[model samples]
Target: MAITTFPMIEKCTSIDRENDIVVTDLDGTLLRGRNSFAYFALVAFDVDGVLRLLFLLLASPIAGILYYFISESAGIQVIVFATFVGMKVFDIESAARNVLPKFYSEDLHPESWRVFSSCGKTCVLTATPRIMVEPFLKDYLGTDIVLGTEIETYKGRATGFVRPPGVLVGKNKVDTLTSTFGDTQPDIGLGDRDTDIPFMTLCKEGYFVPSNLKVNAVSTKVLPKPIVFHDGRFIKKLTPLVSLLIILWIPLGFLLACVRLSVMSFLPIPLQYYAFLATGIRLIINGIPPLHIKKSKGLLFVCCHKTILDNIFLSVALDRPVPVVTYSTSRFLNIFSPIKTITLTRDRAFDASMIKKLLKQRDLTIFPEGTTSRGQFLLRFSSLFAEITNEIVPVAMETKMSMFHGTTTRGWKWMDPFFFLMNPRPTYEITFLNKLSYEFTCKSGKSSHEVANYVQKVIAETLSYECTTFTRKDKYMALDTIVKNP
Candidate 1:
């Protein structure tokens, strides 16, 4: 009954489709090689899949070790069903409709569809849950019979348990099949793993799908590396030191900035000791290593904004208290903040006059992205800043955190800095590019918008991120709509 070779079917095979029943494994056989459970979690749950996968990985070892003491069937049932504990049936159905088509197009076996179409009665039987596979089978593939693990549900949510005849693996699979179709056997069975042999043995013919036929799961490829955290006891011990740094450096940094502004009123070099101290505090708390490629005065620094923390890190990386030009909405807030900034009104003439005054004092920094992002991509650069100066320095900035993200479309601007400080450990990386002068802009006849786009592209490429035309206003509007609907 065992057919080890994958027979090449150039056209429709000579098998009798009118009377014979076809049984196939969904995961490794009909679907290209991938973990069916993992794929289901990712396609259905999105970001939540990371946590689910991590939980499974961590729990699996413990479950395996406990198997020697407990029944192996119980351990498998507990481990497999735990993932669906709180999920709603309706949500799973909706997600299946959205994700299954893409999955099928990308990972379905090249020849399985033809075999499926020609079968008289086709059945998908796998260790995967019946609820998860039935929709795709009945709606898309036009198959009625699906024999798989059954998840117990209460009301609308999963009860984190499987019904009797749990996890169709090994002998349990044979028993379940025998109970369902007594005195009958499949005409053909296809499977990819040794575990599938039990049910496949009952078929008149069996085909072993090679492991190579399985495609790599794209979700696993793009999955982020797991975050390891300091032990709670160790974090507790460092809490006092962290508190001391925040309490001492914040006010000290502000006072130092004020003194530098007062000294700049009369002297040439603005005292940047406060900026250095603030950077030190940030480094100590977050343990971010600042790498400076270029540090020079009087160069305009164009950067991507992720959070208010970007200003502090850039000042440290550049080794200067760079005066920032910000949108006028946060003018009053900046007055009370530690950093020195010039708030720009929407009026072009007013902004031009302020920029002229600021440039005379020292190096100026502007976030042409205009709004804070999640550090995954760059927003469209406003051309207004590029027109202000010819000696432009493009600075690419990125921030990483294991726990919290300090980004908002509709939150108090002043609170963003506090969010960074509150995070247990946040890292910021800044890369300074070669200063873009008039020569770079001269190619497009010194078009400010073109120059701005050029700089934006440089930063986006350096950070390995995509560029978008989304703005601060668009972000807030989207957020507002989500809140209203949600």
Candidate 2:
């Protein structure tokens, strides 16, 4: 069956009607490796051809053992080589094709092409071999007139040598496109790789996709399509191996923490700081990717009054010294093991002075939400702490668990720990959203209540959590309950 051409839609068609947008190149410029039809073809499949090849690879030893005797009689070596190579290529190609359509839905392909074709005469300018990419162009991209390296073909076989235009690198790409298309300039051009920079410079707008980072960094405008792989995805299937790795991490991490603590107890004050830094590194190694912690630098984290161990996990997540902002509670004063840095209670003027001192020294971490809530809910902010002079590097941490093993339900006190020790289950993913900054309204002008609400909103937006202002009176029956029980 002939590959169906995708029709361009209205969304992709924009710019001066008088000018033209000539697209150059594939696999990064116009198409992303991940979200492209090619990417889908390679990844999204039930029984992938690669799997079949792998199965053959696994079975090869057994087959070799069985065929040892038969090998001497027949040309076994030649047969095996032919079979494996043929099967590997066939399966890989087939799997790629099967996965492609799922990524580029029937309607999306046409919509994209309509945007492409509508701009001007659309053409695929790529470094990939023409024969290799043509089928994809015909089926998924719906673009003809592909400018790519022509592979040498003797009859049906691909010869080792490539014909003229041997190298499609750098200026070669631009010269080839300009020479063919002539003086009529393309209005818009897109490429993912640096090689397309020359080609992009020729066009009115050149869109370049950066390394694993989408939203082209180049000064030239980028097309919104194929920036990031956004299919209508609900559930991400984790392979058994990945699930196993996640499960194995719990015990491994616990043991490392214990060991690190033991070593730190005997170390000097300076070494203790190093130990704190090492803790952050350990977290990164153990599967918890860093959130807002850049360069593994130390941070002063101001967190909500939730569980006592939020800092511990946050520290683990950051893999750095997260100086937690804490109240001058007597219980915390006595317990110094977990306390990285302390902010002693002082007069409002003194508190401001102390905050300034802390800010100048290290990276800070803070949870604008004053109180913790039931796992399902978020509490309002108490921004008495947020009246700092520096920009508040805010973090919204959303903790999700398939099973509520380590979670606290309603009526739980602040001291009550959640996500402590539990049997291994489906993974609990803690995501730290982007850091935000807040402008301090005024020394006396910004009401504490207003600051609290603003902080709450920032946290809610970042973490996609529903934030509610819950006072201590509304939540707890008595203040004594926190001191006595918590």
Candidate 3:
């Protein structure tokens, strides 16, 4: 048996020359072992990109079936281009600029980089939209001959329709390469997947990257994993001792919650601290340190929602029992929980009055996102609370679990907390930001929506997560039917 590696180019060639064409696929061949569109969607954290990814995840099964009859390029075009519908070209370009450098620095394959930089007439032939690929290719990589899928735009916004030639997958890649190069085959071709075979055949030399080889060669700062939901399943491989520990912790947690609730009225702070210690959860604070502002009255804490256990973690980290304001529908959780909270119904007038009253007594916390999220992004903040208060504090929260997720969209309220405590050591980090200054708000014209969006952006930036306009309703609608037996 003999061992072999990819052909390595040592010297550079003039890319401007027409005869020196070197075509490469973008996703796995040029970058890491991932799709460029998927990587961009995760890193950019743009609302449209996230929603587009969701649409693709949902429609992939249908697209898979359609692949049998139609061209793979057409199927990919239908699934991917739909995300760009109505997205402004300027917005997409801006997002691309922000993420491309990080991608090139962190996710580019070392072997591919050696091949791409050595060739002068490099053409990126990919199924990813040209709108995303061109900016990176021209501005960052210094190669502009990209033959990617063209997205039709109307009035400077994406129409979500792929142009006539369709996606550059399979035979479409060869067709586009021939049309551009005109009977002259590429000098070299590099691809990772079987779909790239068509274009590879048109080259004098072709290299297929090994599947098992580690592709991404990041030399810069580590990027955060994109916030995507995965279904929760019971650990079938858990040791007997671990399983017994998890089972024992459930009843113990219920007993502790009851004890905390019993004394919460008279000894609220002590009870909260006690419950936190009993759970054995840890805190790993970062970004901004948790501080207890002396002025509790008339203060509004706008925080990102992650789990039902968020209040417990916040109370432990801040060393104070902060009252939380939640939706009326979620009031049932309060029946057993120890934290002090105010429940608000849909009535705008009544809710405002109640929140104002609560703020007058003590510091109040509101999850402006209005529901729990995966903690990788901040959902759209409802402006109702912003309009009611001038003194606002932004809080960014993240939860880490080793065994099981304590919080999920599908889990029932009663059992969610138990699932959280069952983990050997579930940790939470809470960062408290300075109060939103009145002077800054006044300069921005002091609109409630503006204030809400500003705070949302601050939290998103602090956590290195995406800020999105997607709401709780959007989350439930997208995920409700898809996830099963969580």
Candidate 4:
């Protein structure tokens, strides 16, 4: 194949990419952007709340003027200051690792990515903070090297200052590229703006990616690793305007959530469904239990956790409160006063005795996943549910929120229900799968783990979710390093 040299990336014909070294700019080059302010706003809001977000928005005007006229580095410095000053290093790192990937993956530039991803050794040179962009670039895009402006830190907190040599822009990017690759020039370079041209010239072949709104981004499925898990409070990217709207909505949203919770707490189970719709909540239920439900004295309803309110809604669906088994705490979170609670302290023998006693008298529920997930994927199930009962029914639960997420690893766990209800229209869909047949039950001579995995697979297939070996302990340990040796 022959290569056709063209001024813009749109005119490129072909290239032998297997052995070529590629260097690229981010933001406008590798991703679509008005600029990186939206990402900054997202990080600020997620890590520190609306006050931090407002600071960044207020500073944007000054930054914009400096960027267009005075200096790009100066403008970015202001953004770095407003968003990161006085914040813990771990919080920013956590947001970068967990929150930014989904948004960044959605904005990939089609033309730039096709050429950038095909090369042997790929490097991304950007003005965005290295800590902020490295995880997405390495994990999702498979970049080999990342060179970006380095932030200054003191006592494990951001000082809102950059290290000496300052932001990587103009000539700094060229210098960084040469230092990393040494004497051998890169085979190709891709960039989107005039500032990027300095670094692009260092490569043998350079392509310009002009701003193109008509082009669609590549699908997330094409990434090197599928993003199975992510954490954040906001449901969408927080632009300056969007951030403002959220701040204004919170007071009214809080009042509305209180009304919704009150309805669930005081109203009859039959009337709760109608009352939810009247107050802007949407509940979609599917699949009644097998007819064998009539004979149920000890039905074990197992599900992947979605929220604290899950059992409350499960109770509503069953027309009575269901005591939920929890390992974390003894408290059962239910709106109805009649709802009962069972706390398992992770002692197999004691919990087994307690659970066996209840099964003889009534039907109860268990979140075999052990922790709440966003519902796009099912975490590994605990085999204890399978071992404890022969009467297990898998239930699939999913929630959709327009404004805020109801679950978080960092924020207040108790406030999850309030945050969920605060959404403009919060929706939950509950699907009950068929009961485990005698052949698949533990009573049928299968191992407990085998039975649990089967239940996970069934619920995952029903919800169109990918099943993972990750558990609640793995989740906390990954994010917070809370469980050091787990």
Cα RMSD of all models vs. native, in order, equals: 11.8, 18.8, 11.8, 3.3
Error of 1 at 82 (Å): 4.0
Q: Which stretches of candidate 3 lie over 4 Å from their true place?
A: 1-206, 217-268, 271-279, 284-295, 318-320, 410-415, 440-445, 477-486
Question: lDDT-based ranking, best first?
Answer: 4, 3, 1, 2
Model 2 lDDT vs. the true structure? 0.45
lDDT of each: 0.60, 0.45, 0.65, 0.84
Candidate 3, 247-288: lDDT as tens digits: 455566556545433443345564555555565656665544
TM-score of every candidate: 0.47, 0.35, 0.51, 0.92
Best by lDDT: 4
lDDT of residue 483 for candidate 4: 34
What lDDT is obtained when candidate 3 is compared to the true structure?
0.65
Better of 2 and 4 by lDDT: 4
Better of 3 and 4 by TM-score: 4
